[model samples]
Target: MEKFDNVVLNSRAKYGQFYTDPNVGRLLVSRIETAAPNSVIDLGAGLGSLSMAASKKWKSASIVSVELDNLSYFSSLKGNHFHIYADALDYDLPNKIKNEYGEFDVALCNPPYTRPLWKPEYEKILEEAGLSETRGVPKDGRAELLFLAQNLRLTKNGGELGVIVPSGIITGERSLDIRKKLLDNYCVGSVVDLPRGVFSNTEAKAHILFLKKSSPYKKNIKLYEVKKEGGV
Candidate 1:
């Protein structure tokens, strides 16, 4: 990552910097079917790990990767993915969607696990993430919720969403509304349990949540428990 890319946004690496582990990235990409091929959207796409992996799986899959950091932005250029250099919260995402060859078929993101230090409230973090408005920086709201909302907005009908969020968030009281929101909007596919050491620099037990939006087309719910030890 470049020094400028390493520049902190809200006290964390710009572009929500958590490089997805190789094995996990591969697995996540593999989850997307190449048979039908769906458009892929990657938010906070650090180094384009997942983007590149998806491209490898579905050669025809059009990937729209979002990365604000300079280094990650450059990395995205190495692949066949369309790179967007902007904040996830502030970017005109629907425009990008309209401009894409097709509607987004999958929305993938590894959002910043923690809220910004400058303003500990949820609304503040969301505003900077570009997911929502800064309607008076409420003391509530975790970045996790905002990320989910943004993901929902980008994913099309019958599309899938793969998100890596801190485990505590899934069960936390503060995340209650977010959890409900997710269930109401999309069907929970699976929860892949990741240990604390999965992160290169941090100790966060993140859970990979697979979501598929359902209208009247898709029905039922599928859940998987993929548990593995250490790094693969």
Candidate 2:
């Protein structure tokens, strides 16, 4: 594996790539109470930490880790999890794997949060994948929101998903529509806010969202504020 410092200093920051801590990965995994998911996907599976952890827990499950970076994807090759070199946003893996793997039983992700310059094609991709339609974008075009939408679209009806996202998505006015969209589709399970330093080199405050795909959306969503007293 490349030096952590080098990975952070060279490409990750620009790409908004922050690898999940092993302990944090396990914590997120524990939130998934499903007995045995037949198929699992780790979107933006940086270094495959989450995927590796999931593979260990669900020994009989089929795990697929999708990472865009070649270096990270190559490093993941050492693990037992299957790694795919492609963008989770544009690459429609769920549709492709429908015949063999069927819909994903679970999707675990720590999606990129940076607002990259999105082209018109991105909206087209989202529309094609049933994530969103071609409409006026939000005031703050958050890539993280799009990532969440894409993952929700990929997951099977009744499957679960857990994703780490910035706290702003929960509180910010810009995220109101995004939150509404989520409320419309999934049964919001739990949102556990993590401590400041969970992602090692990044300073962004994050929260892990646990959601289940349900047709009739529930009126209530659970919120958890984890204190640093116990150490995240």
**Taking the tens digit of each residue's C-alpha lDDT, what string does model 1 give over 1-232?**
1211232333355334657786777777666542445578888887776787777777776788876676764453334578878767543555556765466788878776544333333354344323344332245444555666667667677778888877754555644655655565456766767655655665556778777766423354444445565332
RMSD of 1: 6.3
Cα-lDDT of candidate 1:
0.62
User: Given candidate 2, what's the lDDT at residue 173?
Assistant: 67
Report the lDDT tens digits of candidate 2 across residue range 1-232: 1122243346546767677888788888888968899888888888677887788788888888877777784343334467778877764556775676677889999887766567565675556434464233552345676677678767888999999988866776655666666766568888898987877576667889898887636667778776777543
Best by TM-score: 2
Q: Candidate 2's C-alpha lDDT?
A: 0.73
Best by lDDT: 2
> Lowest summed-lDDT stretch of 10 residues in model 1?
1-10
Residue pairs with clashing backbones, model 2 = none
Provide backbone clash counts, one per model: 5, 0
